[model samples]
Target: MDKEEVLNEKYDEKLDRQDVEGQLELNEEDDSPIEEVRVTVPNTDDPLMPCNTFRMWFLGLLFTAIISFVNQFFYLRQTQISIGYSVVALISLPIGHLMARILPTRQFSLFGTSFSLNPGPFSIKEHVLIGTMTACNTGTAYAVDIVILQKLFYNDEKPFIAGLLLVLTTQITGFALAGALRKFLIRPAHMIWPSTLVTASLFRSLHHSVEREDDVGRMTRMKYFLIVTFGSFVWYWFPGFMFPTLGMIAWICWINPNNLILAQLTGTNGLGIGAIALDWSAASYYVSPLVTPWFAQVNILIGFILVTYIMVPWAYYTDLWGSKKYPILSAGLYKDDGTAYNKSLILTDGIMDPQKYIDYGPMRMDSFFALTYGVGFAGLTATVVHVVLYNGREMLDRWKSARTQNEDIHSRLMRVYPEVPNWWYLSLFILSLGLSFVTCVVWGYMPWWAVLLAMGIAIFFVLPVGVVQAVTNQQPGLNIVTEYVIGYMLPGHAITNVTFKTYGYIVNVQALTFTADLKLGHYMKIPPRIMFMAQVVSTFIAGVINLSTATWLINTRPNICTKEGYPFTCRSTKTFYSASIIWGAVAPDRVFGNKDGALYSPVQWGFLVGALLPIPFWIASKKFPHITWLKYVHWPVLLAATSNMPPALPYFYTNGLFLGFVFMFLLRRYRYSWWSRYNYLTSAAMDSGVAICGLIIFFAIQSWEGEFPYWWGNPEDQDYDHCMLANANYYGEIH
Candidate 1:
């Protein structure tokens, strides 16, 4: 029989059963085994059943907006950027759960075709949607540093203008880059969007529960919500004045409070031999414990070891040994007067110390050297090639499918969801770069040639970094820092430098990484618009918060922030400023210099290194396809210097063991159906708690000036031992 004939017969039988109501019991429908499984994969072409989008708006959009603004105030603590997506997910849970009970729709719209949320249990799909919206929030951390620029260079005249321009620059550039490379990035089966797994899991649980719901009771979530909120507000203010030790505990790590032995042990000179207790900075390094599964822990381990231990020690040791001078040493400089030079004053205080001004200041202009033209050309070529090769077929298929409905899964998915194509995106990217160059020129911040070079270089290099971040979760910002060295080598009269140009690379990597992660959420039935809006709202909010705090605390050198000869030290500005300098100026010199120190000066050499490192391994894998050991070895992680055994020890001891213990002792032992349902939410709850705690600690103590030891010493506020800032009530009096 034909399928239509069979459906007609079934319809007649259903009608007959309804007519004979006494014999046909409604409760019997619940006994069907198929009804128990509640699988909701929609037919590719079905139109959605109408349901109230108003409820979705409240649950997903509004909730995310409020939460994101507040969370940005705390966690990211940047007025210049925000974390709106976090709130989106939090609010989504309530919406999905509540809406599941009332006006549930099996049909939803995708390009006018119907899709299904697939009627099932109330779950966490709302969170997934929200996460997707916040994807663009990735690069704002760097872009928002324009606030600092405004204060120091522009006399804080147009903070919002700088911020807005930077934001537009980053977004336009990223979108252009992503569009150009979309085919290669999105189409590759080998490129597993790892974050997609998390989003998919959340969506599946929320919309398809044949059994019990896989989440906590509303009360448990509310309890956590209250606890985190109270903790965030309370701890944020406690260290401000009352019990100043709240900040002390976070900033200080003393071996002994008073003794000579203690001073030697706890000093920053590397002689310390104290049992290390977790400070906010060290503890904050522990974020790997939350999201990194056992399989991906190596990248986090390497970052901790390389930066926290090896690179830092090497840099510090070079400063001390003096025999083998690492060209770029500490944040401070030894000036002609023989006292440590004050960098904050030189950079931000707008004051020339007046001694040796002509001789020393000459080299400072090299900081903004032009070399981006070459890199930009290369980047443009790579982007075009990438898309043409990977996306051409897919784009054609999509076009054909749109006309005839003869589309496969990918095409159908694409059709239902229209995204701006590569050409449009690339145009925006180039245009933004041009506009930003003009802005820099107008402000007299960088000469047009120097600005173009920076723009070109940034544009060119963003491609490979984007690829790495999208493909592998690992990042290598040092790769770009090494590139700036080459920029210095180009026969230029000067350069416009930021501390670490590699930060640009890091931002690019993060942009792609976060976007791909959000896409995973997209595929799992989260609304793209919600995720996009949430991310924008959060980014803006974070930018403002970060800018205000960063400026007030980190910019006002020798007053709000003391650099040198001040009684108390403030390292926040020092650390931030030095970091920019190293990447922007120093690293480039080291990498691309004619001097002995410029060993690997050109930044592209590192990219070449990164590319070369993987070839042999990839070739081997292709040549010997059946090697199980080879399959286990992730060469990208290994080649990128992303694996460190040291940090993994504690991680393995705690989280590794914990995951194992839970998997074996609890999950396997219980074997109950309910266990599977609630596991994801259980994990999410813990994540939310930790994020809240870390954020509170970050704002209340970490950003403050002159806490444990200010970056500089004030001559007036000196007692023989500690000191104070100028405006204090006890100013010039010894504590």
Candidate 2:
């Protein structure tokens, strides 16, 4: 048959399948909740394409290396960019089709089942498997942060084997937990992880062809994606390298160069209240404008304004903790004498010297920095309280109904393959736990009791965090809270403190991340066994590569955390190092305890305040049920707004929230058809384009010792963004 006839036949088959499955029809005017919007056509189990094919593994490894190296490199940079999954999804499509066309398709028997080196045609399942592998590897392993801390800050180099084992164990343990929770997270139709829907759309757009008769808009999503992708790729170069000032427009700082407090409130390097950022890289560092919902973005802005604009400025002007004695915004720990804390003086052989620390007096932080930590404590408590208040009943109902409820279309499609067994997950969990425990005790110098306690913390937080991420697309990180608990318990042991925090915080994050991928796999109808193997194997490979890359960078680069390094200043590792000092070397009791006069004693009350903040909102929602908007006031999300104040520039939130409002709220409401057709496709395109350009710039230009010529566009000044507060006293102190 001709192409048109074949396309018509496939369309007819899809309609017949939808009718047979009793699929729910969706319309633009449908008032049904977003969670209830089902696919127009149910997935069919046909062709039975080979999932664990040679081509799949080959591409998985290739991308695993690229993503791991790129992510590790970016993790150390000032901008702290992560390679998004869309980049992988976009790149993998053409490559998968090419492989299908080129590779041998000879059938072979494996354990009495037939398989092929190449699938009959490039299948969606194969595409998903490759994406899954990419997802598992696209971000730097959490253990690398700890390793960087040990090597760069503490001057202690962990053996390569030990570091690799630690990375593998922590990552796999989380995967095991996700595997155990798959039934609850992956099977439920209502647990529509919003990001996965975007991935699904992208996958279908790439793999499936639409009939011209049924196409609503003259422009296809793929065409729009490619056009936008190429445009973004070209546009990024202007702000990314040549004109650094485009990243952060400190207009107020430039206009009023003499006023310290004014500069502190508005400058990007200071409070970042009135800064305008033109760079997408700076704005989307903390939260992706494309993924977060409008309501969440609004709530985040609310908290951000309250803290940075009002509270921080008021406290600083009032000289709370004598804030005027130091720079208005700095992550650096200070001393009672109003000077930078000399870390070298307090360290002897990479361990804290108690006498030296005592002689050095108490460590002090910038007022804004302390406020960020306070908000973090509040965010942690608010997460648990908010989830329980808003989603607790729904979760319980899901658990009860999961046993007997009729399968949704996606679930029905997934029923073609056997579910992964309980023992498989349990065995992996046990093995991972043992490996982690051994690594902590032997290599990390963590106590056995501490290791168990950290694992217990992960177990307790995983479910709530998972629920929040599955529903809201945001995670209230456990880093600060975990550090507080562990620090208080194991005072003066830096290694133990960091190790505990790593296990407690990263384990939950990894589990949630893995569970999100599982939901993606479920949405795409990939077999559970194949998905699990892909993640496990790819994570291992990526972990090794990440560790190697980190090692190479640290060894080759000198003065990593100094001003001399410019973009390679190791800002992330320095932040992690400071955290270790606060929670490990100094101890929370010393900073926030009821001492005669502790600098940040008042901030400790944030935990209590955070726990109670969500109660009023929950009660208000119940009392005035007609005011539907009240239910969406998420305190955890609000608190998260201030969490990035230290590492991320203030303009990040301002610009990102603006885009979120534009796309998620305005466009979605006023231009529903356009929003539905192209919103996520636009997001995917931008992310892919930016990531590809970043890679090219790093490898081709930056790596070759080439430099953009010094000119007006590329200035030689350090603060090219013009974000520095012009107060002589503060500037001198920092310099």
Candidate 3:
């Protein structure tokens, strides 16, 4: 048989079922020429399931968690810091890089299952950074928001078991959320997979380096690592320690006053400061960096303009900021003081009384006034459109493939296109609703009605917002959507009641986002077993550290967890706790339409408008086909947000330009050949080394340096109780 005939026969066999016998018979034909085939062995340089005998991942995760826990402990005590999610990136980037260089080749094989981590022709620098960044991005966010926040709000009363369950639930929820989109995202060609781009860049750079040098010595690599380490170490601290007046103060004003100037100045230090300006950014920086990027996205920046310059100023001028100084009745609501929840008493002569400040700022009497419900309305509209328009076709394709394939019909179909199987989503929605009801009932903190109502509202809207966020990068899932939904539906619930809903919803969203990425990791021949155990262990490690530090500050008197003003407000356990409570319970009143609430900031509203603003131009452009600009309305909003950096614009642009000019122009021109060789490894070495330095700083130096990284505890407080003690108080004794 001819080669083409053989190829055609093989293809036909693939299409047909159980044709091995026929193919063998045909190949055995005496007249047919036997073709000698050469097969290359699959590389097994870095095996995945290395010796199913010993659990390398279990050990790694255990070690990582322990280190994280210990680091967070001192970080909380010294800096009143809680670990941020990005901190994982800070540590992992370096650790992974270093390990990649030093660790022996890992291999695994057991029973019938065998997988190897082959050393690709790529460079070590890229792989190290990719691994480290992955650990950091996924790990720390879970630590700060879920672990610390959970302990802060509920540790006093909930059992350790409950906390564990909550964490697991959050993880599971994240997995389920991402599972639906796994097919579209993980499939080789569909999504651009931006994160992988970062990883690939690092890989290519290292590959170039290896090609340039016959043998990379330990000392040479070490020298390069050290150069980058100390350089970045000093550079990072320059703005934080040397220029605290600007670094710290500007962040404070930006967040509190909703100012942009402070955010711009943050670039002076190369840190993302605009994130601290908004509550969402602050929370998001720890929960998920991908979402936090919105703080600097085109639509978000445009939203900020409308909110700060237009909406907020107008509110201030209109006395909306000063409106209803008399506290309106919370119907029959009463404070912890057992007095009528006097809106008047809370309000000060039609303005929030001068102010009894906490850590972040005064709990403004009219703080809830700035909220707006329109964003949720807009988000819901956009979400439906996105899922149906873009994802709908994909889901149909998955369904078609699943129907013809005999694979576990449910899972395979869901994996390919989860949304197509209406039953699957229906089950998830029902399950989530059921779990939420049980949570409120078991906790007995929120009324049954509140739980049911909150879930109903959340279920109705979370899909649209959550789906939009997961698939195409959109800001529809901003906490504002959940917060407002809760507020609008459950206006009568206490602040804490509302909090439960927000926490549940956000955790659910986060779990899905992270898990989706993990699916990709699994499919790409990355170790699923390792990543899974690593994540689970990392969570508990972060939890223990976060809880201990939070407890310490709560018990610390005077300087600790104060209800006082300015920095104290910033430090108060009550502020974070209260924010969670309000977000979960109040819903629309506090989150959506409340102009005074952070969720309704001019920035948020502006984004809402910008997202929808394109519709009119889109339609008009259709009518006047000659107007090329109208077709590109989205560009202006993105440009506006990009340009909103204020004082930092020159520096940020300069930094990018400097890096570009130096690397692409000067160095490349001078040593064109060497550029390909050194550039990749250089960056990998630099990032990995500095990341290690940063982790050491965080765990060894920063922990002991008298400040915690996140919001663990007040370091200045002289007499704070440890976390174990606080947990004992909350769980052991009836307060």
Candidate 4:
């Protein structure tokens, strides 16, 4: 059947069902096994909707530039604010419609082309395209870190064009891989990227005009979204600005003020045993529980309970790696006397001096930081094994059947538009690879071969990582392991080691993100060609702006990345710089294994543990068919549960999962109609509200001095959560 016929039959069936029943629910007609996608995504398309109109380009470029500029500008700061796509989606809809109404619709001829200045009406396709562009480069590019690190720490000054090229190459290389791997990640019906579903749900809620009788008693999705968003925005002022204690209410710590162990157990910064976060930002920091599947949440919960509650407590109490001396949860590296590790002491001209390194005590970390890295290692291997065991053959079959198989409804609808040719991807991939090689070699960042190795690693791992992300909304990162391999290969080349790691790690991430966006486009029924063009343009714009912004900041602000720079003190970059010193200047073999007082050889066993952990579950799943829960044991997700530790405190998970239980579990099972219709809408609303409120607080209120008076909620001396002792971590005044 033709695309139109497929659309007609499907649309007719749904319309007829609604006409007969008067209140036909989509969840009742959930033929697709993936319930989330079925409820959230519409299996329909308007192929002739003027998606390539000037309105798309204008608004698309506007938001893409704004998002890119804002994100890159704030990236170096201690407290950074990210502007998410939901914000863009929320703001742009009215602007788009307004422009459509205002802009002249007269067709104009330029050169050989004739195009209208405005489309008939604002299209969801146009919105998706706009979002795609912004989504393509939301954060600062991986290579921007390289640029900033070089300028601030290494004092390496390359040409602006070279730095720009480096950023562009690193950022866009993944787009090529995403295009190539679309069959495995995007085409498969089962590969429902959960986050995209939320985005899809948001657009549908905003644009869809009709409402069913079943939705009469319940508020409209858009109305609910707006009310919730406004509520979130208004509510965040307390936690975000005025009453900071509202963010993490550590009531248990308030009960026993002087008790260190109790404080440690209950502190927001510590184990977070009795911590309760009222802040949505804090609540949703690590995991978006509402949109994230219950199975995934359950896996995360299991992993979190095991690692945070059981393993960490055991390791910390036993003083593993002398944990009692440093903070119980910290990402900072340290020395034998419990002072911070000063890489400056052992460095000569930005590279490691072995004799000076010997003079400084071996690199030490608290057991929690050490184990998180171990967990990261475990997560990577488990991802490989887990995907292969569970999804390997199916992926292979899906790959083979791409041409022959009967298409899914969504895929069938998408056939109305032209597909992006494979050569386009191959060509882009080759060009990006060539540029990456050129920039690295020409600018003396690394050897040309190192770039190739990095890209090769990205290609090899993209499918597994993408599959993991598709299934669980969690991607097991290649960052740690990539560093280890490159560090082994090119010892003492700090620049090369980090550059290699970024290329390998961030490229895979970019590919997965692009694939996710593509999946969103698929769900929203955007044309493949338009999606490709939108991403390409946006990536280019975002990359240039990122490099330019970083360059501008480093030049304009002296000592920008150091403490003397004050608020601009590069907190995150310091960690990035530390990683370079650890894995780049000082190779992994020296740093990780038992050597010269260095403590963390056991982290290496995570590789073995991760690889082995999945096999037993697979075996047991096969051995016992009736025991269904055993089959959902995803080691990658579980291992990665504590992946964001050190930065993501235990309370983040505590509150997030509790909310997940209420919404994703209880509401989803009991309140089926409400959950099916409004669940993803609620997630989007919450995120949007939090993001806007955060920006306003940072810029409008908190940016000015003496905005809010200090009170019990916003304490001047003690910890905000009232857990002074636990947050102190035995050391009285450590950040």
**Winning model by lDDT:** 4
Predicted structure with the largest TM-score when compared to the true one: 4
Model 3 agreement with the true structure over 1-735: per-residue lDDT tens digits: 854345335533442322233334432221112110000001112232222222234334545555555444433332333333233334444454344344444555769766434321222322332343234333332323333444433343455444444434433444344444445444313233323333333332222222113224433433443465456556544332232222222233334332232322232222233322211112222112222122223344454344334543344335463422312111122232223233333322212222321112322323122322343344445445545544566656765674333322122322432132435434654564566556556755456676555444544544444443443243344454445554455443433333444454655565445544453343233444444444444554545544554445445634433345223233323433444444443333433343333333443553465356546655687689997655434422232322222213222332333344555456667975544334433444444443444555555654454443332222233211111111111112211
Per candidate, the number of residue pairs that clash is 69, 0, 75, 0
lDDT of 1 by residue, 270-347 (tens): 222222322222222333222333333454344334443454345333432231121121223333222343344433
Q: Name the runs in model 4 displaced over 4 angstroms.
A: 1-31, 404-406, 729-735
Mind giving the per-residue lDDT tens digits that candidate 2 earns over 1-735?
Answer: 854345445654564455444423533322213531343223444425457787788888789888888888878876566777778888787887778667776888989998777654566678878888988877788778888888777778878888888888878888888876766676766677777777777776666555334355468767787898899898899787777777777777877766776676677777676677777777777767767777777788899889977887787778788877777777777776578887777777766666877777778877888988899888888888987888788668777775436456567667777888989989999999898878887885587788788889888878777776676667788888889998888777676788888888888888888899888877666788888888988898899989999889878887776788767887777777777887887778877885423678788889999999999989999999999999889898888887867767667888888888888889888987777777777777777788888778777888676678777556776566564553222444553
Between 2 and 4, whose TM-score is larger? 4
lDDT of every model, 2 decimals: 0.39, 0.76, 0.38, 0.84
Instruction: Please give the range of 10 consecutive residues that has the lowest summed lDDT in model 2.
Output: 28-37
TM-score of each: 0.58, 0.92, 0.56, 0.95
Better of 2 and 3 by TM-score: 2
- For the record, the alpha-carbon RMSD of candidate 4 to the native fold, in angstroms, is 4.2
Residue range 306-375, candidate 4, lDDT tens digits: 8888888899889887787788777787787788888888878888888888888778778888888888
Candidate 2 segments whose C-alpha is farther than 4 A from its true place: 1-50, 77-81, 110-113, 212-217, 404-407, 553-569, 594-597, 726-733
